[model samples]
Target: MTPTPADKPPSQALFSTIAARYDRCNHLFSLGIDRYWRKQLAQTLVLKADDAVLDICCGTGDMALSVLIHTPVHCVWGIDCSETMIQLAQEKRIRRAGRGRLRGKTLRLSVQDAAALAFEPGMFAAVTCAFGLRNIPDRARVLAAVFRVLAPGGQVGICEFSLPRFGLLRSVYWAYLSRVMPMAGRVVIGDAEPLRYLARSIDHWHKTVRLEEELAGAGFVDCHCRLLTGGIVTLTVARKPGPLAAQPFL
Candidate 1:
């Protein structure tokens, strides 16, 4: 299916319609680099077995599953805005068969919006979001919610696509993401606007340094960001300070 520019949704409903194929298009369009980027983010997290993890905007749960496999996190709770995406994530969980058991970890998925999470304060030891923040309209609120839900000394990891700074590499990245990806989406999934929006959002996102400051503003400490693929993607890690304060919501 080749995507036309009109294939993207103005609201959430249209996005749900293509949820089933989103993963497929993502891998194809990114040439499988997406998984590596996610793996990098998960690795940077350095999760321990006792950690309670939350994956926001989990989208089919690839990053969450990665954490379940490589990290010692006791449980991974995945949340996504799209119910269809959650359904697909659950199906993937079933397909994994005994992988969860082998690691002694559990995977949970639910349809939840990032801006309005249903979690108790200081409940998660770690939180992650890969390639999901840009789609959100209110990222600051989401980050604050993430801060509220994380336990002291907890870490947050974010993996997201970003524009390159170097002119030549940025040009190539833009050509591939903005031009080639939409064409591929049209041919592969018969949709285009979703990828188009993806490109647009990446362009519209905060600069890496600015984003790290946003994390600090949300009460995270030792915030940092690493550029991947010539700045085509960014992996951010931040930690909650020790000596937990009572959450106002709690």
Candidate 2:
């Protein structure tokens, strides 16, 4: 059955509740590899100087910050549904600016839903989302919105958690996700439900959707997927067909 927005899980509230400890928990859970994953997604955009970028589901602005730090884009606009997450992202942007690291790049963040992006058509050179797609119920709607906002030749890069493909590693990883992750979440944040929900979401996403095929269905060309860290994470890159479609960064 096709899930509607009403079928969406209560992840936004859960994320807001853990906003303060979100980064710490992610680092702990991923062994600090989350940063590397974001970097990879950022670079996959192949952003050029003076290009404007949009990051949807831009949790805590880490993905936007990665683009600002790694690419020469003139500005990045980030949107998220969680107000707390946007506030934290704003705080991080301010901190990065104070450290004189932004190099005059701009980051504009707001609390906005990814399914209904409030922007003009073809407004950005690239779009990115990291660890955000799994929680969205109407992914086709969001991808359509993403496709509409991207300029012709623009690209989209997504980073998501996936079950490992190898048998032994898959078993070990599932154990860590299903058991250790929840226990650690309880110890660190006094909450186990969110981590449990995370495991379930990853499982559901893996079993139900093929993101690369979804991207193609949304009128994107040159779709490609790369498994990072032994398929524990997948990076999907695709392009809106145009002159730049030939120059993908996958």
- Top candidate by TM-score: 2
Best by lDDT: 2
Candidate 1 per-residue C-alpha lDDT over 75-192 given as tens digits, one digit per residue, 9 for 90 to 100: 8999998888899999988888476443556898999988888999999988999987766666789999999899888888998878888999988878988899888888877888
Which ten residues in a row are the worst by lDDT in model 1?
Answer: 1-10
- Model 1 TM: 0.89
Q: Each candidate's TM vs. the true structure? A: 0.89, 0.94
Clash number for model 1?
A: 12
- C-alpha lDDT score of every prediction, in listed order: 0.80, 0.87
lDDT of 2: 0.87
CA lDDT of 180 in candidate 1?
92
Per-candidate RMSD vs. true structure? 5.2, 2.9
